[model samples]
Target chain A: RMDQGEKKLSSVDRTPLHTEYVKSKLNLEGKDEVRKLKLFMKYIGVYGADARISGFSGYICELLIINMGDFHRTIEAFAAMRGKLVIGDPENTESFDSPAIVIDPTDKTRNAAAAISVENLSRMKLCSRLYLNGKMPEYVQSNGQRKDAKDRGTNLRVFRIKKPDIMDDILYPQVMRFKNAIWEIMERNDLRPVSWEVCVKDHIDVIIESENKAVPALKIHQGPPVDEPSSLDFYNKWINMKISRGPYILGDRIYVDLIRQQKSIGDVVREGLKKVNIGKNIDDQKEAMEIFDPYDTGKDSCALDLFLSKFIFRAHPPEKTSRNTRSS
Target chain B: RMDQGEKKLSSVDRTPLHTEYVKSKLNLEGKDEVRKLKLFMKYIGVYGADARISGFSGYICELLIINMGDFHRTIEAFAAMRGKLVIGDPENTESFDSPAIVIDPTDKTRNAAAAISVENLSRMKLCSRLYLNGKMPEYVQSNGQRKDAKDRGTNLRVFRIKKPDIMDDILYPQVMRFKNAIWEIMERNDLRPVSWEVCVKDHIDVIIESENKAVPALKIHQGPPVDEPSSLDFYNKWINMKISRGPYILGDRIYVDLIRQQKSIGDVVREGLKKVNIGKNIDDQKEAMEIFDPYDTGKDSCALDLFLSKFIFRAHPPEKTSRNTRSS
Candidate 1:
């Protein structure tokens, strides 16, 4: 041990004077070096009986091996430098009957082999796609072919077919009563359907109108109506029509189910309808709900519209070649 | 329509002249109003057929119904003003549908909910766990609980394990190795174990002394020997004795692993031993590899000690029971 210590110290350029000084202070073979090492260990706060053999290397070892000193002094200096140190026995330290130093031949190579093992595990890559009722606007130039989605805009409407086996012959209209509500706004505001930016942002806006009428579009899909008897009936018709149509609309953005939130649409509509100061007649109430609360008008309407737009316009593309193509 | 418009317009008390102008505009009947709406539709670029029935609310519908010219002008003007807008098109003229609308039901709600309907779907939330091996320090707590990889530290090595049923106890050893590496760093620096931040930044120097010591641990896995054949085969016999007894070492900051990097233990040991100048007639390169490298009498022993420390300390943990624990 003394020889080893001398060799180690000599390697570090410790002058003959310093070497003599340390040698005079502690006899490396007489456990004095161990004592000094222990003191340095305590100062660094990280020590293990077989660390040298066990392959544990840390700051405490550096402080002791390279910067030896009294335990208290070393620790004090470390603390001053904002350095942290800790020492604790592992949970199952007694398991090794053989001192870690008693390394076998296999042990020697295993450590070397372990050094080069690759460990890039536990990562996942997911891919998905989204389809729209109409063609997308972006163009892809693949193999010198330029295809753009803008030209397919006219086919945006999701069509419902009454018969799945034979959908081409019959066409059933999905409920679009919401357009009437939109028309009321146009007429009231004398608002012309011109291309205009809605705010200070750069997002584009598009409007559609007939020669003499304002059409309404579904802003959000709240799934099938729950409380509204008419809505329930309407959905039944819509589904049957869709089944017959052969499911032309298949996209990642399409939600087959609606989530229940704070309240149902019927309740919101009913509350809004009740706020009307018109005559107390039932017809008036019904009309009020239709006109005033058109498109379920409320602070939520704007937000709901935004959601629908995002789903329809901005969603990851799906992987599968939409089954809709097969139906066509 | 005119009377209803007049009644509603009368409620807004602007200047009398403004009111008169509004009244005159409101006097138009259905056909005339529809014409004005059509113009707005053309300017805005929205399909009139879909808009009329898409269920747009009064305000949004008004925007949609604005004349195409006006709509374009609005957007252009808004652009000039550096304004932006996001709008929904039921016809999906943009070939994208709206997905979700995020809004606060009440005013000043920090938490908000997004509305997603069956027709339009968005994203979903998933809950999972992450595992880290090693002793956690006090500082780990002061940091935020939610995981933001950007702020990762070194005291703990984290791994996210989403599926355990499919993965068979692979992470335990890897985590152990990672912890061991960190332990090595702590010891080399002569400082207390610091926060995870230090580990990630590689702030702490990890001194892996000699790769020879890891031989025994690697042998347990029965993996290939280090690339180079050497006299160190004798070490395997010694390592086997420990294997017969059992294999497990536990500690807060220390760890072990059967799996290691690409290089074999034999390869590293051979390399390290060859570099040692243990002079004289030791002809077996294998034996030489096992011997510590002899350095010139002017270099620090810290690097050498740290380099070989791994051979003494690391031990693969017990079977992976808490592999998926968020912070094991």
Candidate 2:
């Protein structure tokens, strides 16, 4: 029996405790059936609550199977999910708001599927529908067989950062935070980051794909309207300044063309990283971070594979692969 | 004397009739002062109701002087004018909506300031305020002394089209219509047009200044969201199509990067002109249009001067001339 007035357990601590509670609740016949479904979720890459995976956890899959009866019914239930997916009793599930909600049977206050991101939930539904349609092998078999980085028509920048001596749960979220900060830096500099991915192995590898490698040297700075009181201040500020063009009126607004200090994506990222908060742990080891154009550096095979599978070939199925390769 | 129940006179025919009406209304003493102000208006390049000028006509200037007493008070009245300048009795002026409204003295139904564009009205007010502060010579003397096209940090495209055999009023609007069409073309193709001017001499000279001479070869084309029913259609469409990158999902929306057919501004303009309505008169003579980069062709001195003075030096006063030239 559990202590009545014990403090709430942390997610890491609660997992083992919840497994015991879930095992106690299930009968012998249902236990074997739920175990098979948990393994099935793992096989399809949706069996972790880790920040990197952001999919269904093993315990959540157990709860889903216990409630829905079997693997086929569970897949059918997910395929039919339109908006928010609610499991467990209606009263307990009402408080949780996420892409998928599975009220923890062991601890009613917590959501078992809290870690599932919208993309992952949508991917789960899509995969379930594909599985029902007999197209599962296209997704499962084509995991790491994506085309090379050079084959894709985009400029890729890869950063290899020294991974801090931290646990996987703690390290993964911080790496994701750093990735977001870098994405913002690229966008702020007008580099136009299209897609990005993070792979943590021996080191944290951040791969970003952008539309352009360099921005125009000249940047247009918009100012106040010509009739506004502040327009005089705008004129005074830029009139004597060393600008490329303008302090000229376009329509009603005053604008000046000023020279950008950092034109190349490499230079912009280097300068921008100094100001933005890229997580406390990562910031400490930022000096050890090395930037490379994918062409310059022989990228780690795993990092390249992760980028291609997650981003490049994500929307493509095997039937379309032949056509995509031909056009590309 | 005016005939009753006659058809409405054309602007050209009405000008002489209005001039006679104004002269008869004004006493001999007021006539000399009004005529002097009319000459002043002409000297400052604001004494025409022609489509090219879009400013107060001679008769309008005569009306202003007769109503406001003299040039100094007329300048004072304009300088103090705020939004929607009303120059006649409130009842008749109430019906006309323009930047400036002056109910015609002879024909109460007509707005005498109908031809004056918002820019010209604002220019007249700005000039008046400058004059009030003893800065008239800066505007009057700096007519044709602007710097060369090469010195300015912008890409200039000059088009010398064969001048159509039409009336000045008819031809000027058509030229302006063609200029607008070209501006739209440049904008649609992502060539940012900073400023443009049209000058009609022996040929119709259209000078356009854009941010870049050429756009990137690749262009991003956005499609419907990934969750929408049309996303499958987006996938089907781009899967077979030749594209640079994507049909990839960024955030929620699907996007594809396609190779631009015309990367150069000149090529874009050339192709775009074929599809647009650039006035019936000019369209007939479109084959005679010759494109040039101002550097390749020795630009007409008057056309170059007009581009600089009207666009470049229009915002700058004499005191800032040395500063502007130094920075450039």
Q: Provide TM-scores for the models.
A: 0.17, 0.74
The digit string of per-residue lDDT tens for model 2 on A1-328 reads 1257977678778878877877776787677777776665655566678777787877887787778887888888876766666887887888777877888877887778888877667556655655676655434223334355554445888877898898877787889888898898888776778777777767788889886578655567888755564655675676557665545555445677666654777778777888876787788767667888766675442354445555323622212232234322
lDDT of 1 by residue, B34-62 (tens): 45444432322221212111212222323
lDDT of 2 by residue, B108-177 (tens): 8788889887766655655565567665553422333335545444688887778878888889888998
Ten residues in sequence with the least summed lDDT for candidate 2 chain B: B315-324
TM-score of chain B of 1: 0.14
Q: What proportion of true contacts does candidate 2 retain?
A: 0.06
- Error (Å) of candidate 2 at residue A44 is 7.9
